[model samples]
Target chain A: MNQAGYSEETMTNVRAEKVREVARLATRTGRARSGEFLAEGPQSVREAMALHLHNAGHGGQPVVRALYATEECLDRYPEFEEMAAKASGVRTRLVSAEVLSAMADTVTPQGIVATCLIPETSLEAVAGLNPRLVAVLCRVQDPGNAGTILRAAAAAGADAVVFTSGSVDIYNPKAVRSTVGSIFHLPVITNADFGHTITTLKAQGCTVLAADGYGAADLDVLQDDSAARRNENQDKAMLEEPRLESPTVWLFGNEGQGLEEAEMARADHRVAVPLYGKVESLNVGTAATVCLYASARAQRRNCT
Target chain B: MNQAGYSEETMTNVRAEKVREVARLATRTGRARSGEFLAEGPQSVREAMALHLHNAGHGGQPVVRALYATEECLDRYPEFEEMAAKASGVRTRLVSAEVLSAMADTVTPQGIVATCLIPETSLEAVAGLNPRLVAVLCRVQDPGNAGTILRAAAAAGADAVVFTSGSVDIYNPKAVRSTVGSIFHLPVITNADFGHTITTLKAQGCTVLAADGYGAADLDVLQDDSAARRNENQDKAMLEEPRLESPTVWLFGNEGQGLEEAEMARADHRVAVPLYGKVESLNVGTAATVCLYASARAQRRNCT
Candidate 1:
């Protein structure tokens, strides 16, 4: 057994017991206890290792905790040998297919898995944010929805994301998988008090926009203004744009029951994308993207 | 055995055999041979039934083939009971939890399952479509990716979708579930020839825009000309905005390899979304949504 108490031989073995335990990590309780979640496929594992290195204050080196592989994995990825060799600090374990399958969270293990801790970010780091744009998710239960929203927010240049009570865990393995590693690139806060978050943003002089299906404000009107601002000096123009000057918070609600009446009432503006289709509404993740991009377009138009 | 070698009594008696059969339906060959694919959850089942009704020209009433349910399902959904009461032609088979589990495609069966035939649409129905927008996916292997793209295409007012050769089977249970009934709303053609599709679209003068992450044509730039046109019309004495026109085909490619160089080279235009974040690229689904909406937004801007 190595210092971690997992026998080098046992850790490298594929057993039913290990597979069951690894699959159980899909549940919240199992992940919390183990301080680990499953990340599969080469892209996801690479992102995990990259995030570790990024957080370790290194530019391009790998800062992985543990790297596991099978003979098939090595055969499929000859390049990985050189890459792993460079990360000397990272512990390596060679396991069989049985072990790989047992430790895999996905139906197909792709012959590799890695263990890494979720990096903790302090509230103080995000509190001083002069965010021109932000994403706010309230009671969104599905981890996929929350993760996709975080990804969209980051892509749209939102400075931070705040998840009010009742939302899924940001670190949920499914959520992490959905974000495609954007989780490590942005400030994501969870289990925050809705009232407090709103108050803090309002105090910061930010505009709070609630995205409702029947929102009164038209999305086109915002997009038109933002496009105009982008043509001028961005730094000076940012302050002039109504959407940008007012640090904005976009609130997306639970999958089943959208934003609460009180929560919608608290926002300075309510906006919606026009729907002409048979379906009643867009999924929360899709809606967040449209809304965030609309705000981004609006901010750009007005700033210039 | 009474009709079709599957009598009510025989089905009731052979619970294990039925489950084995249902589980086998996960594969394309099984689904095709049985003339049915699995659909569960009250929402999806409802959608499936509605799809059946529309196909039968019953003016919005479903023409179900069979319904396997427990008392729990009937009790929880009185609407299901009421619908069952009205539909005498459809078969309803009361089942036990064990029976339903065998029939379920999901990890946790919603205590109900249904078997329905895949709907068919012809090329003539979509040819020369004016207000129609369609998503053409080529070789997208991931069921989730296919599903997400379908859902986004529907939201952006697509009239239909077509899956080219090498794409994941649209009837895959996970793909159907991910679509969230968009499958029912849109006409989908699968296993199509690319050369033939491109020829038909060209005959209709349907602009084909392929999405590539490295394309020189900025997606925002494509919108710029249209946005300029809108401003021109408003000025009266100014100019007319250039419109890409609606009913265009947006081609998205495989998840990992993305659009093939040859395929993209033949496109009318290649567009790429700007990325400022650490994440290398957006998920296939998210990327499709952005491109689809950009096109929709451009057309709407010009029309108005």
Candidate 2:
């Protein structure tokens, strides 16, 4: 026991039951039953530890439960040692490279993995927060796309990200890795009811916009119209339309099948990112990022 | 044979030598020696066939050399039959699902795959085309990121996309699959000298902007300044300031290591997308898409 309360013992057995359980976390059932998830790679683990330390100081529950790293990884990231020392409550243990590899989801784990509590928030709680910008992922199946959307939402200053019941599990190791630590930056609500969530957002005075391919409203045209209106009249009413620059909750659909007719109808406006070339359409991740950033830019412009 | 000249003979044996050769195409050496690449999934194969048909009518060599599909895939996409009929030079054959799986890079082959020529072009030819908008990927490693950048560039109406030496192969099966068939929409030049390519673009009067994490200029500030300038004065000289809306080439760096210092210095302007939240940075793919779309929207506004 150093200041961080890390154990001195080294866990070298790859076949140990503890290591096997950690490896099992790579599966969906393992995560659901255990109520825990693995954050692999140095970037994710570092961010998780940092967030844990921040929350601990504020008297919140520790997000990181256990930390495992090889000697080399520990040496590469000395800040991890400082974080572990500060966390006090987290179990920090040294493990062999092979053992760490077994616990990781990627082919190359970079020798560090952390077990974290699955951060969950209720749909009502999220809506009660009065978030100006929100991202709703409906029936999004791909883990990478889900993670990338979370990252984009965080970067664009979104307050929360909501994944409906049909969406991929945000705790999936691949999805968690894709977030590149953004999973810890903001509130992410999972297994949410799509209809109820949208209704709550609408009730809270957030304009709900559905991103679709054959949308009646074009994103470029919307932006141009907003800009033109702002230039023509500086009236508050004209500037306050629930359009690009207003408080918005964007609905992004599945990869293969976009938002269904009912889902699109639930939103205040269906907006399409205009495609100028022969390429059919943008991928979900890229399309969502573009839309979020467009709203971000518009809102920022209005502010200044 | 049907009017499309598709062979009636079905390749049911997955262990055949031809099947093994096709499997080898998943490697870089195989693609280098044969100068051919595999386009998997229905989206990729469909777009390849469409491009082949278009090129054939214009007296150019067919892009798709061979096509492989299951009977179910053919039945689902009858347009493929019409495309094959028009692409008289392409060799179309029916294959079993197992044979298609063995030839595909993904676990699920989507019942169709095609071998296509690498579509080579020279630096001189690219510059001579006087392209108004382009994307230059310098030393990017991830195939998925590379493919997404190509799709974003095409969606932004870029005239061409260039991959410098040391970047991942554009024809990597994973990269091709990620492109979702944008690989067939435009010319993608690989293995070019970055320094000379920049010089040529400069000589052709195209402003080159490098996307960097640390830069003196901010993207939003640039866009705002451009908008303000256009509003203040409608002069031709002001319009030609090589801002976001002008004819330009965007240089994106690798996933882990961003653009080299030298590469950033070579650009006429080094711009950073502003970070509004706690997330450290955006991934290369998402950042590139945002930058390209920003320029696309700006240019379109100026046009109207």
Top-lDDT structure, candidate number = 2
Of all true interface contacts, what fraction is found in model 1?
Answer: 0.30
lDDT per model, in order?
A: 0.72, 0.86
Query: Model 1, residue A74: displacement in angstroms?
Result: 7.1
- Docking class for candidate 2: medium
Per-residue error (Å), model 1, residue B106: 2.5
What TM-score is obtained for chain B in each of the predicted models?
0.87, 0.95
How do the residues A44-63 of candidate 1 rate in per-residue lDDT, one tens digit apiece? 77777666655555554333
Chain A TM-score, cand. 1? 0.81
